[model samples]
Target: MALRPLFASLWRLLCSLKLAIVLAAAVTLLGIGGSLVMHFNPGVFGDLDRMILGRWWSTAGSAAPLLSWWVPVGALLLALLCLNTLCCFLDWARRIRYRWRKGGEYLIHLGFVLVLIAYFWGSLAGFRSEGNRLFVGQTLALPSLPGHFLRLEAFEPIFAENGRPVDMLSTVALLHGDNLLARQIVRTNTPLTWKGLAVFPGSFGRTVEGFAVHIAGVGRTSFSPGAELSLPDGLRLRVLNFLSDARRLAGGRVARGSSELGRPAFELELNHPDGPSWRGWYLLAEGPPSALTEAGLLLRPVEPLYRPYSILTINDDPGAALALTGGLAMLAGVLLALVSFYYKRGRGDRPEVW
Candidate 1:
C-alpha cells in the first residue's frame, strides 16, 4: 500500500488505548537506559559543569562533548511525540457516523488539542527562569530572553556552616520596559510567568557566600599535611604541593610545637621570598599573634572574595503544553466513546433480528 494509506491505518490502529501504553512504555525504556549509565559512572558529575541539563545520557569521555551527540537523541524523543498526537486525532476523525454525541466529545478533545498545541509551541519557544544577583535595594535589569530585562528590587542568600546553601538567594526584579507586566519573586516550585516566559527559582550561587581556604601543606611546622586555614581578607587558598626548605614557625620562649596550641595556623613561604626567607603565619581568630613573624620574611595569607554567578539554564518547550492538553482531551474522548457505545447498545436503536 502507499505510505499515506499505511500511516493512516497505523494511526487508526494506534488510536486505541493500547497505543498510549506503548508510548508510555517506550518513554520508560528510554529513561531506564539513560539512568543505567549514570548509575555505573560516578565521574559524570564533573562534566555536569559543562552540560546543559539533558546531555547526561552519553558519557563523552575526553571527546568533543555530549551535546555534540546527545542533543539529537533528545530531538528524536520529541519527534516520537508527534506519533502520539496522530493517534488521538485519528480516533476522533474515525467517528464520522455519529454527530452530536461523538462531535461534542470531539469538541472537548479539540479544545484539549488546542491546549496541547499551545504547550508544544510555547515550550519550544517559551523561556523560563528566576533571576537577579543584585544586593538589596540594588537594581539590575532582568531578561527572560535576550531582549527582555528585569530590574532587581533585592536579593538575599541565607546560608549554613561549611557554605552549604539553605535557600535560594531571592531577587525581586521588575520589567525593564513599560508596564506590560508586573514583577515578582520566583522561588523553587513557584514560578513567575510573564509574556511567554516562566521564571522559576533554580538555586543559589557561591558568589553570595564568604571566603574560605584549605591548608594543603605547612611549610616548616611540626603539624601534619592536612590543615585548613581561613584568611582575614577571606580568600580560600590551597597548597597544591609542599615546597622544600619552607620556613619553620618554632619559638623557644614558648614551645617548639606551641604553633598548634594558642594558634592553629600555617606559615606561608612566598614564592618571591628574598634573603633570610620572608614568611608569614596567619592564625585563626582564636590562635596566637594576629600576625606572626618567622625567619625574616613579611608573609601574609591572601584572602579573596566570592565570585559572581553569571548564567542560568532556561527551558521553553512548546510540546509540554500540547502534551498536557492532549492527555486530558484523550481521556475525555475515550470516556465519551465508552458511554455512547453503551447507551446506544442498551436503547436498542435498531432491532437485533434481521
Candidate 2:
C-alpha cells in the first residue's frame, strides 16, 4: 500500500506541466551557452561536424570539458523532457474521450515526442565524413557503404574574370565492384543521394598530374611529383615541389601566383654521397637555370602537367526521414487544431480544453 502511493506520486511528477516548462527553459539556456562557446572556440567544436555525435563525447568532448560539459547535461534534460511528454500524452489519452478535434492534440504530442526521439537516434547512429579528396580517374572506397566506391569522372570549374571561382561541377559515378550503380553531376547545392548515403561537393583545387624530365645522354623519362630519380653518376635527384602559375618572389623564392597557368616551376633537390646536397628552383619557361650547368649536371624540364580535383563530403544520416515526418505531423496537427478552434467559435459553443 505504501509503494502504491509512491508510484502515484512519481506518475504525477512525470506528467507535471511545470516540470516540462523548467526542462525546456534549461535546454534553451544550455543551447545558447553552447553556441557562444562554439563561436569563440571553434577549433574545439569543429571536429564534431566530421564525427558521430555519440563517438565525439568520448574523444573530443572528453578532451575539452570546460567547453563541452553542457552537451551531456542538455542531452539528459532532453531525454527527461521526452519522457514527460510521453507521460502527459498517455494521461490525456486515458482521460479524454475521442473526437475529431481532439485528434489534433494527440498528434501534436506524438509529433513532439517523435522529434525528440529522432534527435537522440541520429546523434547515436549518424556520421559525417568531410573533405574526401577525389582526383579525376581515381576511385575512393566508401566508408559507410560496403562494396560501394565513388569515382570522379570529370571536374569543371567556372571562374570569374578576376580569377575567383564562381561555380564548380563534378561528374561522379557510384560503383559496386565492376558494376556501375549511378552517375550524376554534383554541385554545391545539389547533393547526390543513394541508399541513404549523401555525397556533397565540398570544394575544388589543383594538383600536379605528372612531370616530364630530360636527362642528357640518357633517354627522356616521365616522373611524377615527389618522385626520386637515380642518375648514372650515382647522384640522387628528388622532385620536391611543382607549382603551376609560378611566380618568382624577391628572394628567388617561388609561389603560386594565380589559378591560371603562367610560368611552371619545379623545386629539385640533388644529393651527393660524399658532398653537401643542393636545392634550387627550375623554371620551365627558362630552360635549366645556370645553377644546374654550374653543378656539371645535364637536367632539363620537358613539360609540367597539372589538373583540378574535387573534394566531396559523404554523410550518412539515418534519422532524416524520421525528423521530416515529425515536422509534417506537427504542421498538420497545428492546422487541424486551428480549424477546430474557429469552428467551435462559429457555433458559439465552449472551446475544447487541451
Candidate 3:
C-alpha cells in the first residue's frame, strides 16, 4: 500500500504542467547560451551540422570544452520535456472520454513528442559528407549508401555581363555498378535525392591542365602551372602562371579576357646557375613552337584543357520524413484548435468543457 502511494505521487509529478514549464524554460535558456557561444567561436561549431552528433561529441568534445558542456545538459532537458509531454497526454486521455472537440489538443501533444523523438534519432544516426569534389567524368563512391556511385556528367556555369558567375548547374548520374539508376541536374538550392540520400551542389571552380614546353637540351615535357623542374646545365625551369584567355591591355599588360578558350598563354621563368633569371609570357596563338632567344627555352601552349569541377555535399537523414509529418500534424492541430474555439464562442458554450 505504501509503494502504491509512492508510485502514484511519482506519476503525478511526471504529469505535472509545472515540470513541463520548467523544462521548456531550461531548454530556451540553453539555446540562448549555445547561440552566443557559437557566435563568438564559429570555427569550433561550424562543422557540427556535417557531423553525427553522437560521434562528434565522443571525438570532438574534448577539443571544444567551451561548447561541449551544454550539449549533454540540453539533451537531458529535451528528453525530460518529451517525457513530460507524453505523460501529460496519457494522463489526459485516461481521465476523459474520447471527443472530436479534444482531438486538436491530443494531436498537438503527439506532434510535439514525435518531433522531439525525430530530432534525437536523427542527431544520433545521420550521415553527412561535405566538399566532395568531382571533375567531369569522375566518379565518387557513396560510403553511406553501399553499391551506389555519383558521376559528374557535365558542369556548366552561367556568367553575368560582368563575368561574374550567376548560376552553376551540375549534371550528375547515380549508378549501381554497371547500371544507371537515376540522373538529375543539381543546383545550388535544388538537391538531388535518391534512396534517402541527398546530393547538393555546393560550389564550382576551374583547374589548370598543363603546359607543354621543350627545353633546349631536354626533350618535350609537360608541366602544370606552379611546377618547378630541373633542366640540363644546372638550370631550373618554373611555370609561373597560365591563362586560358589572355588579353593584352593598353599598357602592355596581360589579363584574363574570359573563361572561354581564346588566346592561351604560359608565363615561364628560367633561372641560370650563375647569371640573371629570365621570365616571359609564351602566347600560343602567336605561333606553334617558338624559341625564347633570351632564355634559350622553346615553349608551346598545350590545348587548353581547362576543366571545371563541382563540389557536392551528400547527406543521409533518416528522420527527415518523420519530422515533416510531425510539422504537418502541428499545423493541422493549430488550425483545428482555432476553429473549435470560435465555434464554442459562437454557441456561448462553457470554455471549461473544451
Candidate 4:
C-alpha cells in the first residue's frame, strides 16, 4: 500500500510525451554517431567482436578501441524508448472518451507499438548470415542446423567477348545424409530459399584445383590460371596461358576457342626472378606437366585445375514474418489515424486532434 504513490509517480513520468520525444531524439543522434563511427573506423566493430566474442558464432561488446561503445548504449536507449511509447499509448487509451473520432488515435498508437515490437523481436531472434566457399563435388556442413549439408554439383562461368566473365552459376544440393532435400541453381541475383533458409551466390576467387605439387613445407601448390611460383631453388616459374578448353588445329597445333572446355593445356615460362635472364615455354597439358625442366627443377604438375567456385552466403531470419506483419499493421494504423483526424476536422469538432 505504501508503494502505490511511487508506482503512480513512475507511471506518470513514463507516460510523459516529453520523455518520448527525448528518447526519439537520442536514438536519432545515436544513429548518426554510429554511421559516422562506421565510416571512420570501418573494422573497429569487427575487431571488437573477434577479440571479445571469438571468431565463430560471434557477438559484439564494448572492448573495441573506437566507437563500438555506442551499440549497447543505443540498444538500451531504444528499449527505454519502446517502454516509454507503450506507457504513453496506455495513458492515451485511459484518457480517451469512447468515441469514433478517437479510433484514429488508438490505431496510430497501436501501429507505432507494433513497429517497435517487430524491431525488438528481430533484434532478439534474427539470424546472423554465414558464408562459405564451395568447389565442385565439395560438401559444406551447415553450422546452425545439424544433420544438414550442401553439396556443389557444378559451377559454370559464362564469358562474353574476348573471354570476359559475364555471369556465374552454381548447381547446389541440400541433403540430409543420402536424402536430397532440395536442388537449386544459385546465381548472382537468383537466391535459393528453402525451409526459411536463403542461400545467395556471393563472390568468386580462383582455387588451385587439379595438378598440385607438394613442395616440402609449402602445403600444395598447383599450376592454376595466372599462377606465379618462386621456387626455393632460386628459380621462378610463371604460367603464360592456361587453356581448359582447346582445339587441335591443322598439324600438331593446340589452339583455344571462345567456346567449349576441350583438352586442358598450359603454356608456362620459367625464369630467374631477379632478371629475365633465362625464359622458356613449357607446354604442360600438351606434353606432361610433371616431366618438365626449363629451370632444371623437377617441378611437376600432379593434378588438374578445376573451375573457380562461387562464395555462398546462407541466411535465416526467424523474426521476418513478425516484422512484416508488424510493419503492415503499423501502416494500417497510420491510415486509420489520418482518417479519424480528417473526419473529426471536417465536422469542426476540435481544432487539434491528438
Candidate 5:
C-alpha cells in the first residue's frame, strides 16, 4: 500500500511540466557551479560535492566513475522527455476546448527540442581521436581501433622570410601492413581519411631528415647524397654532380642554382647512361646531366627527404532522439500555457468555459 503511493507520486512528478523546468534550470546551475568549482578549487572539481540546496553535484559516485558520464546525461534527458509529454497533454487539453492559438504556441517550442536531441545524439557516439608521432624511416602504429595505418613519408614546412614558423607538410607513405597504402604529399587543408577517421597535417621537422648534414664545395664529384640509381635493362647511374650557380675555366668550376656548392666542376663519374643519364644542367627533379668523360650522368639537388605527423576523429547516438522528442514536447507545453493564460485567454472566440 505504501509502495502504491510512492509510485503515484513518482508518476505525478514525471508528468509535471513544472518538474522538468526545475530540473533544466538545475542542470544549468550545476554546470555553472562545476565551472566555478573547477575555477576556484581547481583541485576539487576533479571530484567533490557539498550541500544539497546548493544543487548537489558529485563525481565517480558509482562503482566506476571515470568509465561513465553517459548515465547522468541519460538521466537528465529522461527528465526533459517527461516535461515534453506534459506539454503534449496541455495541447490535448486546449484542443478539446478548440484553442488553436494555444496549440500553435506549443508547436514553436517543439522545434528547439528536436535540435537539442540531435545535439545529444551527435555527442554520445561516433567520436574518437588517436595516433602517434614518428620520424621519416619509422612507421606509425595502427590505431587500437579498427583502421588503416598512415605512415609519414616526408614532412616539409614553408616559412616566411622573417622566419616565424609557418605551414607544415607531410609526404605520407601509407601502409596496411607490410603492404603499402596510399602515398600523398599532405599539407594544410589536405587530409588522409579512411575508416571514418581522418589524418590531418600537424607540426613537422622531427624526422631522419632533420639529422642530415649539408655539404657544399666548388667541385663536380660522382654521386651527391641521394638514393643510388638502379636500371631495368642493365647498369645504373649514380648522381655524379652538383654546384651552386657558377661556372669556371676548362680546368674547373661548379654552379648549382643560384648558390655555389662551395666550388665548381672538379671531377665526376657517370653512374648511368640511360634513364637519369645527362639530361639538362638546369633540370627540376633529377637535376641536370653530367659532363664527366662524356658518360651519361645525372645532377641532383641534395634535398634531405623525411616524413612526420599525428591523427584527429569526429564520430555519431540513439537516446538523443528520445530526449529531443521530450524537449520539443515540453517547449510546446510552455508556449500553450503562456498563450492560453494570456493573449488568447481574452479572445472572444475563447469559450467562457474554464
Candidate 6:
C-alpha cells in the first residue's frame, strides 16, 4: 500500500509539464552549444558522432575515437525528454478519456510524439551527405552506395552579357556496372532525385583548355588559328585553324566562334622541303594528339585543355517524408488546441488548461 503511493507520486512527477519544459530547455541549450563548438572546431564532434552513432563520416580523421564530454549528457537528456513526453501523453489520455470535447489537445501530443519518432529513426539510419566538384566525363565514386558511381556527362552555364554566370545546368548519370540506372539534369532551383539520393547544383566555374607547343629555340608558346612561326632552319609552321570550341561544320570543316570556347582545339600545317607538308587536327580537351613527331619535327601538348564544370552536392535523408508529415500534423494540432482551449470547459475537479 505504501509502495503504491510512492509509485503514483513518481509517475506524477514524470508526467508534470515542468519536467517537460526543463528537458526541452536543456536540449535547446545543448544544441546551441554544440552548434557553436562545431562551427569553431571543425570535425571534432563530427568524428565523435560518427564513431558512436555508426553514421557516415566523411571528414578527415573521422576514424579517430575522440568523443566530447557533452555528447553523452545531451543524449541522456534527450532520452529523458522522450520518456517525459510519453508519460505526459499517457496522463493526458487518461484524463481526457471520458471527455471527448478536448480531442484537439490529444492530437497536439500525438503530433509531437510522431515528430520525435522521426528524429530518432533518422539519427539511427540516416547517412551523411557530401559535395563533389567534377568536370565533364569525370566519374566520382559514392561512399554510401557501393558499386554505384556518378558521372558528369555535361555542364552548361548560361552567362549574362557582362560575362557573369546567371544559371547552370548539370547532367549526371548513376551507373552500376555497365548498366545506367538513372540520368538527371540538375538546375539552379530544381534538384534531381534518384535512388534515395539527391543531386543539387552548388556552383559553377570556367576552365581553360588548349595546346601549348614547344619549339627548339622558343621554350613554349600557345598555338591558335592564324598563328605563323618560322623555324630556325627556315621552315614554317602555321596554325591554319584554331577552334577554342570546335564543332564540325556543314562541309566537314572544323570551326569555332566566340561562343565556342568550351572545348578548345587547333589544326596546323607544317612546311619543310625535306619532309614535305603535314597537316593534322589537335583537340585540347580529350583524345590523343593527331601526330606527336612528324616531318622531322617534334610537337607535343604542354597540358590538356580546361573547361567549365559544375559543383554538385548529393544528399540523402530517410526521414524527410516522416518529418514533413509530422510538421504538418503539429501545425494542425496547434490550431485545433487553441480553438478547443478557448471554447471547451468542464465541471469541478478538472484541471485548468494553460
Best by lDDT: 2
Which 10-residue span in candidate 5 carries the lowest summed lDDT? 48-57
Worst 10 residues of 2 by lDDT: 345-354
**Which portions of model 5 miss their true places by more than 4 Å?**
1-15, 40-108, 119-124, 130-161, 165-205, 210-354
lDDT at position 164, candidate 6: 91
lDDT of 3 by residue, 101-126 (tens): 66677678878988988888878887
My TM-score estimates for the predictions, one after another, are 0.45, 0.70, 0.70, 0.61, 0.41, 0.60
Error of 6 at 142 (Å): 3.4
Clashes of 4: 5
Q: Candidate 3, which ten residues in sequence have the lowest lDDT sum?
A: 287-296
Candidate 4, residue 203: the lDDT equals 67
Q: After superposition, how far is residue 162 of candidate 2 from its true place, in Å?
A: 3.6
Give the Å error, residue 71, model 1: 7.6
lDDT of 6 by residue, 1-354 (tens): 899999998998887778888889999998888778767766565454433143533333344335344555776898888787777678778877575565666566666777776666666665555447789999988776788888999989988999998888888998886689989888888887764567788887665545677765656876755678877666788887666677656764676756545666678777775766777666655543434344345555676445677788776556667767767877887788687665664333344322
Distance (Å) between predicted and true CA of 39, model 2?
A: 3.1
| Runs off by more than 4 Å, candidate 4 | 46-61, 89-131, 162-166, 175-183, 211-304, 347-354
Models ranked on lDDT: 2, 3, 6, 4, 5, 1
Sequence-dependent TM-score of model 4: 0.61
Error of 4 at 350 (Å): 7.8
Better model by lDDT: candidate 5 vs candidate 6? 6
User: lDDT by residue for model 2 over 35-150, one digit each (tens)?
Assistant: 89988887888888788788888888889998899999999999999998899789878877744446666678778888888878878987688889988899999876789899
* Per-residue lDDT over 191-299 for candidate 1, one digit per residue giving the tens place of the 0 to 100 score: 5554444555555553312223323333331222333333333333223222212234357122123311232344433332232323444443323332232222223
What lDDT would each prediction earn against the true structure? 0.46, 0.81, 0.79, 0.67, 0.47, 0.69
Clashes of each: 22, 0, 0, 5, 37, 6
As for candidate 2, its clashing pairs are none
Compared with the true structure, model 2 gives a TM-score of: 0.70
Clashing pairs in 6: 207-306, 208-306, 209-305, 209-306, 210-305, 245-260
Off by over 4 Å in 2: 1-5, 93-100, 178-181, 211-303, 344-354
